[model samples]
Target: MTRGLVEDEKKEEETEKKAKKAAPAKPRKKATKKPAPKKRPDLEAHPTPEKEEKAPPKTEKSAETPPKIEKKPEEKPLEYKNDIVEVSVYHKPGCRIEMQIKASQDMVKEAHKKAIRTVSKQVNFPGFRKGKAPPEMILKNHPRDVDKSWQQVIADVAFKEAQSLAKVSLLD
Candidate 1:
């Protein structure tokens, strides 16, 4: 019984091996070639037709209606005087002689003399009594009085003239 069973196992293994070897193999397919693409034309190679720039259509009503105009009120000219202030000098030492006078050189000199005479009569100097000293003596002996009187008189005249100038500036 054992020998017959071993002989049956050997027959089963041989039948499996024969079945595997008896099966037919599949055939391989040949590769196909692809078609080439056609050439494309360049746009720059052929010139395009020049197109006319079409403007937007305008209405007749818009042409008849003119743009609103603005009229500004005329400005008044800045009131100015031709009175040229040719200030040859702005500031100087108290002892220095500097002025702005419209009169002639001789007239201005004469005016200075008159001013000195007038001021000397008004100021009280030390000694030699009051309002009695000559212009020369007052200028030499009482130099302080001479300087003060001269400044005061000139200032008074200048102040009167400046009043008009100040008014013009304020009004303008």
Candidate 2:
């Protein structure tokens, strides 16, 4: 009986080993490649049409509007006057002269107007286009800034005239 039992156990072990060997292996999964990034549009290669490149029409003026009255170019307040600014120089030692500069009311006003025009070009005001802000509004809102710019304009003109009269190079 013991020999018979031992023979049955040996037969069961042999069958288990054969079943495992007969079974097929599972298939391995392949790695997937990532999609490539898209390229940007080439503007130089394909330029925009001329019609599409045009700027939007200004709202202030239209073809149907009445012709504006032309004023004399000299009437503009920004016209610079070289003769209006009076300069008095006191002689000193070492090629250094003490200069006294005085600008008339008209000249000062012109300088202020010119400064406004310059400042207006750089800034944008509400309901106004670039370089088109009213002088009154610019003066009212930025008085100190406009005054400083006007002073700088006066100094520049004075220095240039002084340099020419002195017959010497102003820059060291």
Candidate 3:
């Protein structure tokens, strides 16, 4: 699960950078190919007297082979074909989402354990000692299963923060 996303993120970033035109340097334009340089007139081979100087120097062949220039096709604008959803920010009282979201999801889980203990001390569990389970252990047992549980608590805190702001009319 973790491995897959790491690789995916690289590709995603590359596409995003290209789409946003955030590349460090723009792509260089490609060059066209040109015909190979011709043999210099002075460097042309002088044949020995034995063979009567090879057929008048093959001049017709070089003349027939006109110099050619080749250029690569221009690239199109960088297009991000991937789907990107839009998002909006709504100001609400007692919303602590910004501050709350700052903490890692794990921190929320820790807070939940703390809350659970706080609640459990005043209440009782069937077989366990009162508040015996450490927040860490309770969390370990639940493990990654409570993935969104942290977010819910954070959202709740954010709502409370937002509401607090609203109470003071800050959001107004």
Candidate 4:
């Protein structure tokens, strides 16, 4: 059995060598280089003489004609007006603007009322259904929540008024 196995291995090796010899070899490509560009002559070394031509005679109409002056329309300043809020705008560098808004007392009071109503919706009180409590009771019980809501409402109102006055769109 060992002799047969050894003869089989030798036959396989010989077949592989014969197969390699029968296969054709691939051709290799040669590397190529580009030629350098030619140099151009300098223009300053060979300067050409310019021809002198007589100037055209000016007519009476052309000599007496005055240059035209264009007039630009004047621009009006922007005027911002609001009953609930006062806005003062300041122009800054890079096409940016800064606004100073002052809310009226009436606007503040209105915002405070709205804030109490908003806060009342989130809280529960005895002898009252959820979100149905009175604003006075809600404010008495949830002072912090009411104040936060009032601040948010006032900020929103001020921003809206400023945007309208400036005639500019603002991102929320």
Best by lDDT: 4
Error of 2 at 95 (Å): 2.8
**Which candidate tops TM-score?**
4
Clashes of 2: 0
Task: For each of the candidates, give the backbone clash count.
Answer: 0, 0, 17, 0
lDDT of 1 by residue, 1-172 (tens): 9999999999999998898789776667879788786656763478779999998687897778997889766443323222422122223446442334332344335446666677677767777566676788766766676566656655555444444533323233
Write candidate 3's Cα lDDT for 8-99 as tens digits: 99999989978788646776889989989998989989876675555556677777998788966643322211111111223334762222
By summed lDDT, the worst window of 10 consecutive residues in model 3 runs over 78-87
TM-score (all chains, Cα) for each model: 0.29, 0.46, 0.27, 0.51
| Clash count in backbone of candidate 3 | 17
RMSD of 4: 14.7
lDDT of 1: 0.57
Reference-based lDDT, each prediction: 0.57, 0.73, 0.53, 0.84
Poorly placed runs, candidate 4 (over 4 Å): 1-79
Displacement of the residue 146 alpha carbon in candidate 2, Å: 0.8
Error of 3 at 100 (Å): 11
Higher-ranked by TM-score: 1 or 2: 2
lDDT tens digits by residue: candidate 2, 80-100: 234665556655559766666
| lDDT of candidate model 4 versus the reference | 0.84
